[model samples]
Target: MSDDRSPSTPPAAEALTRCDALVLGAGQAGGPLARALTDAGRRVVLVEATHVGGTCVNEGCTPTKTMIASARVAHLARRAGEYGVHAGKVHVDFPAVQARKDEVVAQFRSGNEQGLTEAGVEVVMGRARFTGPHAVQVALPDGTHRAFEAPLVFINTGARPTWPDLPGLQDVDALDSTGLLGLKERPEKLLILGGGPVALEFAQAFARFGSDVTVLERGERLLEREDEDVAAALTEALTADGVTVLCGHQALEARRAEGGLSLRVRGPKGEKTLHGTHLLVAVGRTPNTDDLGLDAAGVEVDDHGHICVNDDLLTGVDGVYALGDVRGGPAYTHAAYDDYRIVRDALLHGTHRSWRDRLVPYTVFTDPELARIGLDEQGAHEQERPARVYTLPMSKVARATETGETRGLIRAVVEASTDRLLGATVLGAGGGELLSVLQVALHGGLTAADLREGIFSHPTWSEALNNLFMQDPVEVPGAQERNDPR
Candidate 1:
């Protein structure tokens, strides 16, 4: 039979929804943007192919952090004697932990859905593809199709785990971040094939859960984006927790072992086969722009499949924009939400708010946590910017000594001429929270002297900044110090 459906024609009026704004994905950006646009008395349609809240709420932050908390509790319980409390045999109930994580995820997802419904935004559960510059054809869940048209459209489809085309990798069973989170049973031995933030975080969590974990990283160190000292500190922390880290190693092949899975790895020591009960591939993430029909809409994507957006988050197509992980740049949920704000300001208020030169801060939820803001010591040196470097061991922080969590250190890079805080890294307990102090200070154009002499409360992690900035400048190799203001 000849096909009767015409691809160019728009759907009938009854089967099409025309709105002032259309949001492609109900992710971090889409959800809030949809609500804001709807509240502004504009008809908005928000479509989500999967669950709401995107990666942060569903698979990435909420679920993983919930389980990580449970793992932390288990670790603390085992270390009860260190705190002068005699707590016997700490047991980890894997199923119970998974259940709690599920509960948390469901609650957050439900809350997001309810909020969208209450905001008078039309929430469509379907996959969206651009049929024209200003129109999309949605494959609805009910085995039906609908078309949506709007002058303003926002794409926030986010990203997914990138599966590399390594030989035998696809044949053997491997878990990504999402699959690892859904695990109900504790793996006896876990083999992770990356040393980035996600890989290290999961490595620590699983190790604390009593799993013999080994991390194989292709780069020279874990968290390669950070300075070498920072990466070494994290490596030390992980090693102290019984994680076998193999840096400068590449996964040559994967095969089914007798009991579990076997990974052939090649490093400086030569090829070695590692066996594990579970294998997790936490290499990286790729934007979900493959099936978006971006070409039809005249929206361009970069080499990595990330939608190319201008500084204002525009996708080159008029009234169309990209946000969050799908638009590349910083793949944090906060960055995505900020993209929404930038777009909102441009479209709603007609203001030109650029998404450039903004300070981006992030944290890795390891045992002591690793948090950073702005440039690192290496970045300053590479840029040939003269700066004063300061390093303070966690042992110097009273809170770290008292808490017995002094495994990491704090490092700060400050411009010598201006005394302005160029960057800071907090690697001790509550590092993410403590990094915020420096973040605020830097954002307000505060200098190292300001932080050094600030009256910070004693016996707290934040107080470490006082000692960090007070230390005399240490000359780093290949770094020329500008004239010190002091």
Candidate 2:
């Protein structure tokens, strides 16, 4: 990270290119912001070190989900007998899957590049360093330096995978999320080093693709942020998919093995040796802010290296703003785009929309997806907000029962006093898609009774809501469902 360096001195004046705005990285937020700034008749310069699209198209969402789709086909083929289809034995073509993923990624990246070209955004392919509050110098590919000076500078370099601090881990050639996406050979036995969404999603996908996958989570449970029941349901689904999920386990050390890789782990029982063809460390990611010499611009970053920003996404420095994963909270592609919108309106329309209190919904791309929005049961308890929890097994949903994909649950929390919907978690097939219904209801201020009494088309997941909200509410402590709406 640039934070480790001394303050940057200004670049040569003759080589500088002045622009109305400078975007540091062509990530989710920075790419769109660059074009938008150009549309506003402002000369925009977009500096990208590698690909046109950031983690999303190049590594994270696009490539991974494409392979997940391939894995889903293998999973379905194995279960074809249940659907009365006589499909042959399922086998994954690892190279073919990689090719498809690469093709999709290339198309997305080219689209972004084409758009930037049409919009006349001057793109300097280089690593960016802040020389001052309004000045940035780029170390170009051909050993030349290019500098940009703008009144407004946006940082959107996003984040990358962080390695865990286990002894010998770095020496072992373990894969990060990006590296895993590009692996040439499928692991015969895969070991995952985290319990978060990245670990869980990839665990299920590779397991379905025929890898003997083991997940070692340091916490007592996977998705420690989610409610116990919700996390348990997801863990069960992954286990049923043939993934060995070991919670409360920490990697003591890692080393290169005879055939692949070896990890020594400790659990409640005792220390054990786990062997795998590959290891993926999906613990988390840190911002790219550290290497940009933010201190030179007087831009503050949190202890974790995330750039500090206010409700308006404005940094401490007046002309500088940080967007997307670099700004820290809610590191999702959609959230990053919304950051663009916030700053877009503020600068172009003079309307400073806030970053606080935004509804961030996310889905884990597993067989039976885990989608969540707003507060969960534990959150209500922590906030000491009165709430009523209602849970329905997927077995109870007609669609789930009919499809024979009844492996998860849908849980909702409603404000006990007013019976208004607060949050919902969907953990079933197409759960991510189903979550939009709950999101819409919450966004529209719909109540439990409203959904319970509402009519939905027959045998659809949406129709399950009629019975979901009709269930007897589990009254949480200090919370009771009331007949009064107000």
Worst 10 residues of 2 by lDDT: 477-486
Stretches of candidate 1 off by over 4 Å are: 2-14, 476-486
Per-residue CA lDDT of candidate 1, range 1-486, in tens?
764656545455527778999999999899999999998999999989999989999999898899889988998898899999999998898999999999999999999999999999999999998988899999878867889999999999999998877778877789999999988799999999888889999999999999999999998888878989888888998998899999999999999888788999899989999999889999999999998888789999989999888888987999898999998888888888888898888878999878887888999999889999987888987786778899999988899889888888898888877889889998988899989988999989999888888888887888888888778876543333334444
TM of each candidate vs. truth? 0.96, 0.96
Itemize residue pairs with steric clashes in candidate 2.
Answer: 1-290, 1-291, 2-290, 2-291
Q: Across residues 1-486, which tens digit of lDDT does each residue of candidate 2 receive?
A: 443534376434537788899999998999999999898899999999888999999999999999999999898899999999998877799999999999999999999999999998998899999988999988889876787899999999999899878999888888899999989888899999999889988999999888999999999998888999888888988998999999999899999989887999999999999999899999999888778988779999989999999998999999899999998998999999999999999989999778888899999988789999998888888776788988899999999989989989888999987888889999999999899999999999999999999989998999989989888887765533333455
Error of 1 at 442 (Å): 0.3
Local distance difference test, each candidate: 0.88, 0.90
- The Cα error of candidate 2 at residue 391, in Å, is 1.3
Give stretches of model 2 more than 4 Å off: 1-7, 10-14, 479-486
